[model samples]
Target: MRQPMIDTYEEAIEAVRACGILPLAPLIPDHPSLSGITLPERWHSDTELDPWRWRVRFPGDGIAAYGKFMKKKAILVASDLVPSVRSLLGSSRSIAQRYGDGLISKAAKEVYAIIEEEQGIETRALRAAAGMKAKESKKEFDQALAELQSGFDIVISGVRAPRNEAGEVNGWNSTCFETVEHWMEGAGIPLAPMSADEARSRLQARLGEHSSPQAMAYFAKVFGF
Candidate 1:
């Protein structure tokens, strides 16, 4: 598939809302890579035909415009499709079952709890709140965060760029995390109640059209389809 160039933030938002789901980049394992990806890079710096400009621009801009950001199947998903996706993937009961079965690690639980208490927090603030601020524990902290994301418990809701004394933006943007429910509410997105089996079946049918059987199975495992 040919990669699309999104020249403006409005264009990026329109693309995401339409797609319902997309990779943070233009990566499809089975396809040839003619160009790189979008959002995190400079918006108009596509001196070449790469999509980095669109990739870097989408996540933060989408969140502000009307979208949710979560690690879906290890890739970032910024879309209005989150409410339906979450409903299909897991419910409160399923999540509770995972916790009761000890599938959720102590560190992940701690990290999740902090985010729940604070509503929405930046990564650094989350680390401090979870008391995993030590350098050596960084890996554990990262893993815990990823675990939460993979389980569909939390998401990167926004990004924060610090401003200098003169009011100029400085440094890379820090990601802000929030519970899936909180994120939905903040974005004014609504969740439609759907049975887990129905949701999974719909997802499988949609993805199976484009993916190999093996890839479909991998997606099922990753997304809890």
Candidate 2:
């Protein structure tokens, strides 16, 4: 099938439906190996498809903001496939393993604790609450955040418009973080049902179909697909 042109979120949604999943532009522009326009430049490309609207409109609508194909910041997935992807990643197992292996670094642990306590918070507050504000700690903080997202422990639920110190709107909205369950509850999204092996196999098959042999190999090596 010829992939659709994706200039908008609706188109992006269609693209996700057609391609199964996509890498965010920042990570792999052109989605290198996928069929025609397999990915959009950004999910927040327009007012129609901002994160906040995405939650209200397609909550449970598949689009893994945490991304799976790469360690990059974002990726999109078909809604029905979210649960399967989570299962395939053995997210629950990864979480446990991370804890067991002490993969949850101190910064990550601190951030996780804050999100757990607040249920949901904007990035600015999260950073402050977790004491990730220091410039020197940025790398560690981001790495920890990525680890949590990739493991399906936390997710970007929506965007909270920026506010001035006086509590008035002042800048663009900030992305909000929340636990997977909490985000889903707010978005009215639910995970699709599939066994862990089945989910992994399905995603793997899609990757193979959409990417070149070389790319397929790379994906397997990089993403454990």
TM-score list, all predictions: 0.69, 0.72
Residue pairs clashing in model 1 are: 37-51, 37-52, 38-55, 38-56, 39-54, 39-55, 39-56, 39-57, 40-55, 40-56
lDDT score at residue 42, model 2, on the 0-100 scale: 37
Question: Evaluated with lDDT, which candidate comes out highest?
Answer: 2
Q: Give lDDT per model, in order.
A: 0.59, 0.60
Instruction: Give the deviation of candidate 2 from the true structure as CA RMSD.
Output: 4.5
Tell me model 2's lDDT, rounded to 2 decimals.
Answer: 0.60
Clashing pairs in 2: 60-189, 62-79
The predictions' CA RMSDs to the true structure, in order, are: 5.1, 4.5
Could you give candidate 1's per-residue lDDT for residues 121-189 as a string of tens digits? Answer: 878778988888999999999988878776668876666676679989888666777787776676666
For residues 156-203, write the lDDT of model 2, one tens digit per residue: 666678887899999877777777766655555665456766766777
* Model 2 weakest 10-residue run by lDDT: 26-35
The model with the greatest TM-score is 2
| Residue 214, model 1: Cα distance from true site in angstroms | 11
